[model samples]
Target: MMMFRPIFASLFGATLFVATVLPAIAQETLPSWSDGAAKTRILDFVKATTTEGGEGFVAPQDRIAVFDNDGTLWPEQPYYVQLGFILDRVKTLAPQHPEWKTKEPFKSILAGDLKGIARGGEKGIVDLVMSTHAGMTSDQFAKIVTDWFATAKHPKTGKPFDEMGYLPMRELLDYLRDNGFKTYIVSGGGVEFMRPITEKAYGIPPEQVVGSTILTEYAIVGDVPVLRRLPKIDFVDDGPGKPSGINKFIGRKPIFVAGNSDGDAEMLRWVTAAKGPGFAMIVHHTDAEREYAYDRESAFGKLDRALNEAERRNWLVVDMKADWKTIYASEH
Candidate 1:
């Protein structure tokens, strides 16, 4: 009788809690999102997955949503924020590495020549990252990233880089989290670089971030054991790597995935291809007024293959110009 009484009370309490919470979920959701198919689709998915005894209902622990950091959550146009960090780091470290003045990528970087950096391609960028991001301990690198974000401003918006996360997307993150979904940033940007500001910017913690990373070596600095950053590529969490990183870190396939470029194709493909009811959305940079709009030919955040795939798969494509009433948070 005692065991039965306790179980009945627990069940009654859960029912009463759901009775009060479900209506709130249905009513107040994504206020920043404009009225459109994109908004409707997102709400529908959340409802289906969150409602009790629904066919698409997902357990709260299983309700994982992954998002690409660049372009999707924030602007990655003109140049990637991490690349800018590397350039700044180069200038700061130039006195230590005197030969950088004569080096190819370093020479051009010091001269503030974006054209030369572009010409250096993936290899040049990797070189720059290795030179600037490496050689420091992991803790030191994290401090450098946090310090950089304190002052770095977006060239176009003139706002601090940390202040440039998309308003609608930030709202979506909060909405999903409020609806029992765990939001994670699965980006091609550096893991260390993104970790410092992700918590403040997106409400996602550093532990939930997965991104490209460099190898680090364990060392003893006096009495402290430290992981010193090495100038070697450990992982590139872009394209197919996104899914791999997601699986590695989150240990579960996300039911919802948001991305802004072809680099995120495989991640979306992995998510939507799963057996259950899944949702995938691509952020099409259509608003030239609020943000930069280049897809196929853009050096950063190229949205070609993923754009075509989204259309063919009937996935929601968010038109920044029409769908989002405001772009940046400051706009609101």
Candidate 2:
């Protein structure tokens, strides 16, 4: 009877072990986000929307998440990539327009006078882009962007432009996709400029990207159909333009939206205003040690208005210094 009791106790202990281990195994198999409330909230939202019997269960088609490209997904420091392209363009075109050596914005750019360039502001940026990006066919523009991205490296990091992407953001993107979310890049950079490299860098295909665009015209160039880039601005995917771009390009409002600055305020507002369940987040760059950090005073990714709005709305504002264990994957 004592031997039988010992065997029974051993079997009971084994059963308890299995019961405890199986659930932990199951949970471990699930995609684990960074350790924090933000990760938990994101996982919870995704689970609620994807689970079969959950109240927020959404069809695969409706699982749309839109993310801002610059600053949100990657580092947009020293200025946006489009600005880099424009600066390079200025350098390239400088020889032809030697007068640019004496001009205000062009001269500032040629001389690498960043302070003078800063003084030019939004109007300066617009003029530079219009001058450089226009006159070429859309195909030419695409090829130009592809060539530039292949060669250009970030100034401070000395890494390829694509490699500067935020590591945690990439993980989040993959996790969302695994859970059936279709992620889209909504950016203020030119659509053509981003289309060539976004898929390789961010796991978002060209079809899922929306950005600033110039008017184009279809014409036959030597019996080949071509789209010529016109100087006319079709759209600028910043501020209010963001929501409009999403509506025009994606048609359906996104269930999840992530952005970094006041430029993305309207997009966040638009997503949160949808009739049903929605989530919005803003990445607050606060870690100067790991990566570049600036908020309200910075020209790029300025966060004042967005911070206030995020607080008022109870939106998640991820602090890079606090939330992230690391910044870029390359650094790790």
Candidate 3:
């Protein structure tokens, strides 16, 4: 989830979908958010930070906002959308790798033994990602991800994966941009995988997206220069890595951050704990009907430590069921 590069913007070759998805900038901000303290916090922070001569006033150049992609912007259960991609990919490539029938995670994945797959643990997950995600040129991999997005649907709603962005959050993004905040996505998802669809779905260009990455090298293949993806992780933009990745990519502390899960705990603390005018928000997935609800015990987006820390840090914990007048981008 973080440009990634101009390549993604060029490959996508489309303009922002905000005009159709959200109201004009001059209209009411976050209209899909129900009246509450959560909404008020966002409004108050934005107002205080943008106003001239105010104690919290932040220059437009300094007004940066970073957001986590999975649970924060969309649903993460029954599992992450990227995991769905991984599982499908493992199947698609299985016929070529017959030995996968005996491989630890692959065997379980093919047999639909999620518990067995989990038994393989983090190494198993990394192996799965590297096997399918690397070994191609960056351009080729991006196309593969984009093509998958063209057809991938959420298991629950049967809607296109990219189409499931939360409507209220989308409005919040547009609203922040309208007020001069440069928004970025700092997520654990692969940067290239997300770059293809983020601009169209969230009105955030590829260059503004940051996420986990694998190694890549410049090479000349068939007399043409290309960057080839390698089967080695370069960085992971989650948990403690989120803050470091932000510093390396953006070169400044953001005034606002949004996320859901303990994986984003460090980012939340890093932003809000800054000297002044910083706001951190957690999108509490509490709506079991409009959206699936689980917090402490959820495997996909566990939100325990961050939920407990929100009160002490004064971070806004958005109760999805209570605070969202609408859940999905399509709801608008």
List, residue by residue over 193-252, the lDDT tens digit for candidate 2.
899999889888999999999999999989899899998889989999999999999999
Q: Where does candidate 1 clash, by residue pair? A: none
Off by over 4 Å in 1: 1-28
Q: Please give, for residues 131-250, the per-residue lDDT of candidate 3 as tens digits.
A: 999999999999999989999999999999778999999999999999999999999999999999999889999999999999999999999999999999999988999999999999
Per-model TM-score versus the true fold: 0.91, 0.89, 0.91
RMSD of 1: 9.1
Model 3 C-alpha lDDT versus the unseen true structure: 0.92
In candidate 2, position 89 carries an lDDT of 84
Reference-based TM-score, model 2: 0.89
By lDDT, the candidates rank as 3, 1, 2
* Per-model CA lDDT versus the true structure: 0.90, 0.87, 0.92
Enumerate residue pairs that collide in model 3: 1-210, 2-209, 2-210, 3-206, 3-207, 3-208
Per candidate, the number of residue pairs that clash is 0, 0, 6
What is the C-alpha lDDT profile of model 1 across 1-332, one tens digit per residue? 89899899989988987899877766766766788889999989999999999999999999999999999998887888887788889899999988988887888988988788878888988888888889999999889999999999988889997789998999999999999999999999999999999999999999999999999999999999999999999999999899999989889989999999999999999899999978999999988877977899997898899989998887889988888888877875
